[model samples]
Target: MMIYLTLFLEFFKIGLFAIGGGLAAIPFIQELSKNYGWITQEQILDMIAVSESTPGPIGVNAATFAGNTTAGIFGGIIATIGVIAPSIIIILIIAHYFAKFSETSIVKSAFSGIRPAVTGLIATVGFEVARTTLLNMEKYNKATNNLLSILDIKAIILFCAIIYLLNKYKKHPILYLVAAAFVGVIFKY
Candidate 1:
């Protein structure tokens, strides 16, 4: 019961402030991993991968995954509701008033400002994720002085291959995800 309440409240706060979209919620999820013991950094990465690969919104999926991991099915339900509740309420309010304020400079300026901030947030999350996935910090810390030893060569190669394929093929994302999963399984990544 207490865990459910905590999950709801934490996810509610994330939903309220994660402005752009599911990707925007990632930093908040990362914070949860840091501040609470409910999830780990590795688990956050897994959550992101699974969330992206599965259906529905990534934020809701992450909340459900985290809550379910922490507690149970009921916890997942509560957390999902909590994460989406803010968006629902905000959308309702915006829908009611947006027409009246659509032409106002204040509203326009607010959105203009929000766009850059959201972009920055999303970019930061991307960098963090890349750093965690491509580089092995533990290896870096353990290494005597060899810089190349710190890099996860296999992961980097896989990442580059995926990026190249994405650019060259321009196929649906699911295809890439499936291919990556197959590669990971085959290579034991």
Candidate 2:
């Protein structure tokens, strides 16, 4: 149907320009969600968490989740294909020319330029995610847009705890994630 077609085209555009990786695609996905009213900002965060916890690439996982939510199984299939098509094409093209261009200064310069831009994109996404995670937007809006009142103490404490644990122990991330989940459930944060 038309919905499936639209899903494919939209995700195709996302995959085409989503350089760096899945985190880099967050902004584009946010735009897509906003433009289409396909999902809420909170849902996007949930999708990111689920995608990260799952085995597949975050962008692909997000596309499939969005497509499924929008339509059905067929939509998931089509959207996933659409999202990955560009990567396949680009990889093929790069594989064909990489050996020839690997030593060229122009290619090296281009990659060097891209590296920082990608890092910035990822950092931007991280900032956005942290802002959403640590703040209560609804409370802010309800409290006449007071910034201080919007700060979620539980979230901030949890965030600090996670950071402290990460710095102190340097243990596997899953342990931290599990501990956070347990805290969230117990405190209802």
> lDDT per prediction?
0.89, 0.87
- Tell how far residue 35 is off in model 2, in angstroms: 18
Residue 16, candidate 1: Cα error in Å is 7.1
Which tens-of-lDDT digit does each residue in 1-189 have in candidate 1?
A: 788888999999999999877989989988888888888888888989999989888888989998888788998899899999998999999888998897799999998999999999999999999999999877865447878877999999999998998899899998988888999999999
lDDT tens readout by residue for model 2, 1-189: 898899999999989998877888789888988899887888888888988988788889999987887778998888899899999999899988998897899999998999999999999999999989888877766537667878988899889988998999999998988887888799887
Candidate 1 residues lying further than 4 Å off, grouped into runs, are 1-83, 141-143
- Quick one: best TM-score, which candidate? 1
List TM-scores for all candidates, in order. Answer: 0.60, 0.58
Question: How many pairs collide in each candidate, listed in order?
Answer: 0, 0
